[model samples]
Target: MGSMSPIRGCRRTIMMSSVLLFFVGGMSATDGAPPTWTFVTGGRIVGSPVVTETGRVYAVAEDRYLYAVEHGVARWRYDLRVRPIGPIRVSPDGTVVVRTRADSLVAVNPGGGTVWAYRHRTEIASFEHGGDGHVLIGDSAGVITALSATGRVVFRVAVGDSPVTTILRGSGYNLFAATRDGRLAAITDGGARVFRRLFEARIEAMASTADRVIIALSDGRLIAVDTFGREVWTIGVPEAARRLGVAGAHIALISDNAVWFFDNSGITVGDDRFDGLGDTVIAGDGVFVAAGNAVYSVRASQPRAPVARFSSGVGAIGAGGGRVAIGTDDWVLSSFGNAHATSRPGIGARVPYWRTSYDYLFLKDQISAGTDQAVRATREMISRVDRADLAGSYHTIRELLIEVATPRTPRTGRVIPPDVRSAAVRALGRLGDAVVRDFLARAVAAETDPLVMVAIFDAFTDTGIVSPEPILEIAARYLSRARGAELSGEIARAGVDLVIAAHRYAGYVPDVGVELLRRAMEAPFPREIREYALTAARQIDGR
Candidate 1:
């Protein structure tokens, strides 16, 4: 069975800073729980929750209703009459539109009154709003249509020979679409074609900024194209991208089990693995991912670690204007810390969590469970750490050290011991603070096993520890002994690790590694150590 204990931002500049502080400081201060306000709905939410500028929340449910929620109470609800065919969208001018499986587009006013309806001949496969109060629709019959603000048909034309799978609004009144047969087409608002391009692989996902449109293919290729359909740059990923989205210059691509972030120049900025990721959004300086029953927020400017997490059966998420909101399979709509219209003054009663916190449970299991127990946990906790919440953070760090720094597995009968040590060190680095750094440095000194020492050095590098004088002193002693007679390859390997760590942590090799590497290359040190040191020196020098 899938692990039952499952797992799983916005703002302008000031909004971004507030969000960072909320998660960075709020988690440990509030007993490791981030504050959340949830509004219960009548049925399962089928679409993403939309939060307006004034903090009103709108969401669609499988029960054929669209709800307008103000604070924790329903302001009004309109019967959608049929299941929503697409996500409920609020236009720039505050017109709410939802497409039904009946192949009709329904527009509603902000006060829950019906505005207009446009009926289509075939089932609508995709739809998007043209920013200037125009609706773009694509149907399974290979037709593309544009409707004005009043539901008047602006243009209707056949674009391809297969179903239109994607539709998006570009600069001004231009519309872009992709077909099932690997065709991409762009047209102006007046029905004039700009360009069309065909590819060998089917387009799996498409996202655009103001100037470029990015498409991810089934063959694990991502291509950025201009408005004229000219290729700008392409990147070959390890796996086919299942979903794609753009947040500023950062492009987020979700493959089978990992999330990859790339800049417009095609250089990778962030990459990490998370299981069961369902949706992703980039707002402010962070990337928000929805997985299982949780929404995880990872900062883009800093380390690729989850800084904040909100627990719910998150089906879809949306964030903008300094507010973050989510819709869940449990029919609950939630918002985190924003002022808005509310019938009540304070928040509702806290919703008790089945598992208090995933990270907390993982740490507890690591410390309390026997090595033989098949305990499940999450590798979360990637954010800035400080002294304000040092108690819990240090306690968890100690548990990690017990699990990882131990000489052997707790159980002798174990056949394949868990590799929790490396994970533990990585967690320590993700924690990223003076306490963590000091603990790791002490662990490196006390550790006798060569293999564990290697892991400790790697962790030190990840935690931004450069110019480690004490570790270097120990490494020089071991290197000298290996040169004498013992020939300890592991010790030499640790020296090489420190060399690389210096380069990565502080952007340059320290004097210790450089001097030792040069000496090893000249004389009777073992051939393996000489070769490794030479390679490390070259890498450091190149950087």
Candidate 2:
């Protein structure tokens, strides 16, 4: 059986912060349950939730919806016909552009109503808006699609070996796509003939300032490239990591557990002794990082502080205009106290969560008896949230539990906060149900904190020769959006280690464990974690 739970955001391309605050008396990291989570809500969470000017946050989620939430209440919701897994493109005209999971490119009015929707041949993995309302997008099969303002498809060309991330830039309309196989593809207005492959490993993430293109390689190198695709400077870290995003000249990237920063020159210059982001000292640092339990502010020369501390680690950080938004395990979008957050009227008494939240249970109910039990537990837990003597932001989540969860699961007992789902995931490893498998995948996709992913490592086993490929694959994609030092390194190692660790479950796998041994030799983990990984590797190799 598999263990359930994991959740994983965004901001300035995101570096640049002039805000700071001191945090005291943190909330329950765990609700004292055998394994618990403390999910946080109160922000704008669009699919690509980013902090905006004046402190408003925006984000979109799998709910097939886009949200503008400030404080604990939603500002508006624009429903889509399908899921939205792509980043949002805010046009200069104040138009909100979104790419749906069904491969539709749609434009929305600021009022949360649809203005246009364009469908394509394949599911759209992502999208971006450029000048004259031209939207650039890439599909699951490595094809790029360009659409005009009126939802008409203009260009659809195949690009990259495995295009995972992309950006549209330059007044001349140059498109950049970072691929899984260590390549960057550039598409011009005429077509996407420009291409360049770099590094021996995967390109986990990509970022660009006005003049520089930054690539976060799967092998742990932060390689800077010019517009001509020429390597500028390559900064390598102790462990293979990913670059989350860059704001102005400030860059935020992550390895496993900790988040860190660099400058336009590619030097590690942010606070390393503390949280590393959102600090008074790094007031002008332009870098923002969301780590376990906190969203950080960092500058090149100073230490950092917390912007709004939550019990759970942030799944993502998004910034726009003057505000910031965050996503948590509970799948809720939250923002800090900004004018929009404060002045924004109640979501006009709209209900929290979508009607489809509980529908997942019906979809999987016939799968097994275990599925039924799990669903019932979740729903039960949600009910307690309504009557339990809970205080704080959790009060706002009661409605979500009822709406998002199926009555069959009711989620049992006290509210499980996002911070502690890791323990629950670890404990549920013995159950091999498919429900567990799917939930685990979801947890990983939205997980912003590595501790939670670490917990998941114990739950699901690939059941093969203990190949680290799957885990590495997940880590590579995760590092693509992950920011900061502490987090980048830990997650990269864990993802790889999980691959080696899975061998323990096979009992009769192969002895050709080159990746495992290599990881044992070169992985940048604490002695204890390294030794554990080595033992798991040895089990597969019989060494």
Candidate 3:
């Protein structure tokens, strides 16, 4: 742990005074006003901007700086020295709290001074602040540690066997912890375990009201549990819920393409469908949604015109103190007050396709040129072939990528770079052609580079081939080789990725793949390998 110090500096801050004109989408407001003030950061914003009740804004960017902005100007920015994880929270005492990639929780005061920093032993999975100025941090080891405002530990308790995914403060000092394996526990203020309930599916998101806790499961079920861990209601949605927001008796559920609004009784009131919505926050009588390149306010499942739109895609949105803050993908932060803004469309461009055989001939010539520029051209070809609608040249492009990715003896003193090979392998995986699965498996067998091996496993998983024979053979070979020897971290991680890839085809070869993974569980590999093997084996055995 290092000393608490504020990194004093400001990135170029742009303050907009008037609205800029741009093309408006259908049903968009042409007379929309611009944001009251806008701020730019050095990097893309990580999570949603946090706006306090006093109109102070706090945002964390990929540049590892937590910025405090007031009236369109940066008040101060504190350097976390590493990327911030999860959300930036404002505690009850007005102290800004943020978790860093260094596994530490840093507290910054209103004056941009460091108050305290508490380092955790394991990777933090869930973090929350209570009303009484206490911070509850959950780690991957399933332990919950509570710290007071002064950053002293109050209690540490193990809640489950898997990683804790969420932690929420319930009525009074009672705390609720949800694990990755779907177990929810209620702990007392003094860290006494009261009860635990296990669900059939993983919990994805959780929100709390005054009287009950709302949870969204990976199986598309929204469940409400009381303070005593009793279920109140459970309703299934068409798709898995991504985020949840609770406001009074209204509940907002955001999925991949739609937003569903429900009453307290789990009855669907209204729903709206959008293409690229990411997050939602409930304020007053409406829920503000981050969709595409704009933030929209929806009431009764209908978008009440456009609220604010930006040049780039909006990553997150927040509202407080009669103001709204939006962070865009291009590292722009804008604050609005009663302004209806619209952005220019065309964020997504059409994928270029091969129109004729000459296109394939040109690419083949570039790949066969055997130079550094050729390697760059090959990389560009990989990107172009990924997810594009290939016109009759799919096999040609796939075979070209396979040739570049396959480990072979160098010819004419020409060798493919490891990263280029990995990218080519991943692009083949994204192509999802079943014809390439066998090639990828064989590559995995001959591949010695750990990164390329990981890419091969990822490709196998991405192909959705459903044949478990290749993965099982490769996993068995690795496990047998690692029985008496310690594996490096990269090798161990590749082994875990192989197990996970095999898990995808568990239903196809239950007996062999499950047995191989079970043997891997008992093998003398790293803890991560063993854990992943156990998890895959259990899923295959339907335990």
Location of the lowest summed lDDT over 10 successive residues in candidate 2: 339-348
- Tens-place lDDT per residue, model 1, 289-387, is 776776666544554543234444566776655566655554444564321111211212212442455655766665455544422332332221212
Measure candidate 2: CA RMSD.
26.5
lDDT tens digits by residue: candidate 2, 1-543: 001111222221221210111112321122211211122322223344655453434566554556554443345656665665566777766667766645566687666666777766555666676445777766665666666777765544455546446554631234577656666765445342333455687877776666657788877788887654667999886655544565434666655545567787888766353333221111122445665666655445555545555655466656554344555444544443321122211111122443344444442342234544544544444343323222122213322332222122355443334333444454333222234445566666665556666556545542111234554456545544443446555554555555554443222323333444444344354566566666666665678
Which scores higher on lDDT, 2 or 3?
3
What lDDT score is found at residue 278 in candidate 2?
Answer: 29
lDDT accuracy of residue 14 in candidate 1 = 28
Best by lDDT: 3
**TM-score against native, each model:** 0.55, 0.48, 0.57
Question: Which ten residues in a row are the worst by lDDT in model 1?
Answer: 1-10
Clashing pairs in 1: none
Query: Which candidate leads the pack in TM-score?
Result: 3
Model 3 residue pairs with clashes: none
Query: Which regions of candidate 1 fall more than 4 Å away from where they truly are?
Result: 1-38, 304-312, 337-543
Q: Sorted by TM-score, highest first, which candidate order results?
A: 3, 1, 2
Better of 1 and 2 by TM-score: 1
